[model samples]
Target: MQCRIISIGNELLIGDTVNTNASWLGNVLTEVGIDVTHIYTIGDDLATMKDILSEALSATDLIITTGGLGPTHDDITKRAVTELFDCELVLEDSVLDFIKKVFKKRNIPFSKSNYHQAEVPDCCEVLFNTHGTAPGMWFDRGSVKLAVLPGVPHEMKHLVNEKVIPKVRAINGDTEFRRSHYITTAGIGESTLSDEVVGSLVDVLPEHVSVAYLPSPQGTRIRISAYGSSDDEIDERIAPVRDHIKQKAEKYIIGEGKDLNLAKAVGDLLVEHEMLISVAESCTGGYLANAITDVPGSSRYLMGGLVAYANQVKENQLGVSTDDLNSHGAVSKPVALQMAKGVAKQLGADIGVSTTGIAGPSGGTEEKPVGTVWIGFWNQDEHFAIKAHFTNDRQINKERSGAVALEMVRRSIMGIKEMPYGFKKYPA
Candidate 1:
């Protein structure tokens, strides 16, 4: 089935709020074998909503809209939808009762706005939202299946999972199903991964089975997609290409699953090797530590971390050399190395990792530019630091630095000698 997402809000257009709803909906629909062809982001204007929604309803079999469902007068998605279908707004008693009870529990009076929220177009089926006040509406207008959901991410997600999915599945009856496997990789550029490591998929990939390289701030996710009558058939069809890619990119591959990340993969390795790890973060400001601890059961291998941002903290807490700080500056390889070794010693960890960098829109020198990062690693066998140059964007630099650190840790644990992206290691 074909789908189109209409994200309604001025906030999205004006860059105040991101259109995450459309992307989330697209992912959900695509997983269920629907091809999401168009995404429209419009303001809360009634005429624009009606026009765009009308065009969308005509364009696709399944039309999903988010936002503009609120108590305020600026919210006009419901009104526009009602106008398009030539239906009068009518209050749903069950919906009103639910809202009133919710308000009573919160000790707030049920006002006219709340009553207005309970009203839905007379022609459409009311998709009662148990979590929020705004009622989701489903319209079956001629050949189109339209579902209007709340713009709030959690609420929209809830409604989509509960109300919309079942109806979609029932309507989907015996249609083509899609199965996708996500192979995540870090510390490698997308071009190098595709051109050098994995190479072309033209010969290995079957007619419909394909791969998509999705690059992110931290890493790359290669999604292998296939369509078949059943998931089993799809998996069977996708096996050849998936296995080939896996074999080719064995060392670079973090792990399987759509959500597998560098930290999680490294955490698994630490557990398997019966080792504990600690971090001393500078420019990344505990980002590396946060990533590591974000994984479930991280306490098993993590010995906590120190955000040694200041030179004094690095000297005092992480036990960096005061002479090294004076001679080589805070973002130097020696400082990074000292921080790693000191953290391991201080925390009594089997391994320690440290990051020092200039993640900035400013504070760059002629010799040491912005995005210059030194990632240090220390263990019983080896201790080394790698210098890398990332983008000027502070957030991206921080993320990339963390990713590089984790990938190197993964490689080191796995006994691979080459640093991530073939960066030269500066060892003391």
Candidate 2:
């Protein structure tokens, strides 16, 4: 089945409001074996809404629309839909009562415009929305189904998951269900992971199996998806691709699951090894520590961390030599090495990580330009620092540095010899 999502709001086109509802619906619909072909974002003009709705209904099996469903005067989705279907607006007494009760419970006066929230086209069925006053409407025109939802994200999600999906499943009971399994990897770029690490998924995947690489600031996640009549059938179809990816990129692969973060992966590994870790951050400003502690139960393996932003703090707290700070200007290998070792000794942890860099649009020298980052790792047996050049964006540099630091911990604990991005590891 094919789906089309229509976002009706001038705010979206003008960039005042983001159309997150379309992306959410697309993901939800695709997981149920429905292919989302196109997304339409238009103003609240009644003619444009009607035209787009008509076109979408004719071309797609399912059409879902969000926005323009409020008590305000400019709200026009219900009117446009009614005009398209050549139907009259009818007040739903139950919906009206619910809206009144909601206003009463909130101790707000219900106005005449509030009645518009309860009115729907007589041709459509009301999908009761307990989350808000605006009821979602469902229209079935033989082969095509149209769901009209409110602009509020939480309300839209509630209706789609609770009402629209069940209706879609009931209608397409015989359709094959599709599911995706995610394999997440850290410390690798998307191109390297795609072309070098896990090469030619087409060759390894069986029939009806496909792969997609989703890259973010944290890491790259490979989505292995398959469609089948049963769970076993889907698993059998997806196993070969999953296994091949694991075999080729085992060193870089952090874990499986779309929601997995690199910090969480590192925290899990530290716990497994019964190791405690501390951080001394300079350019990243404790971002690495924040990322690590973002994981639940991180206290099991996380020791305290230090920001060490100023030169005095680095010298006094982390015990970096003032000579090195003056000679190397705080963004070099020697300072990074001392910071890691000092943090470990101060916190009495088994492992320590440190980040020092010029993460900025300014404060760059001829020797050490912006995004020149030094990540240091220290343990009883191993001590080294890796030099990496990232982006000019300050926030991006911070995120990438934190990711590299966590990935360094993961790779070191797993005994992977290769450095992140295959950059050479220098002895501290």
* Per-candidate count of clashing residue pairs (backbone under 3 Å): 0, 0
Q: Which stretches of candidate 2 lie over 4 Å from their true place?
A: 100-115
lDDT values, one for every candidate: 0.91, 0.91
Tens digit per residue, CA lDDT, model 1, 1-428? 89989999899999999888888888888878899999999888888988988788778899999999989888888889888889899989999999999999999988898789998999999998998999899998768899999999998999999999899989999888787899998878899999999998888889778899999877788999998888788988889988999999988888899878888999999999999999999999989988988999999999989999999999999889999999999999999999999999999999999999999989999888999999999999999999999999999999999999888889888899989888999987
Taking the tens digit of each residue's C-alpha lDDT, what string does model 2 give over 277-374?
99999999978888888899999999899999999999999899999988877898999999999999999999999999999899888788899999
Q: List the residue pairs that clash in candidate 1.
A: none
> What's the TM-score of each model vs. the native?
0.97, 0.92
| Reference-based lDDT, residue 3, model 1 | 90
Model 2, position 245: C-alpha lDDT score: 95
Worst 10 contiguous positions by lDDT, candidate 2:
196-205
Point out where model 1 deviates above 4 Å.
Answer: none
TM-score: model 1 vs. ground truth = 0.97
Q: Report the number of the highest-TM-score candidate.
A: 1
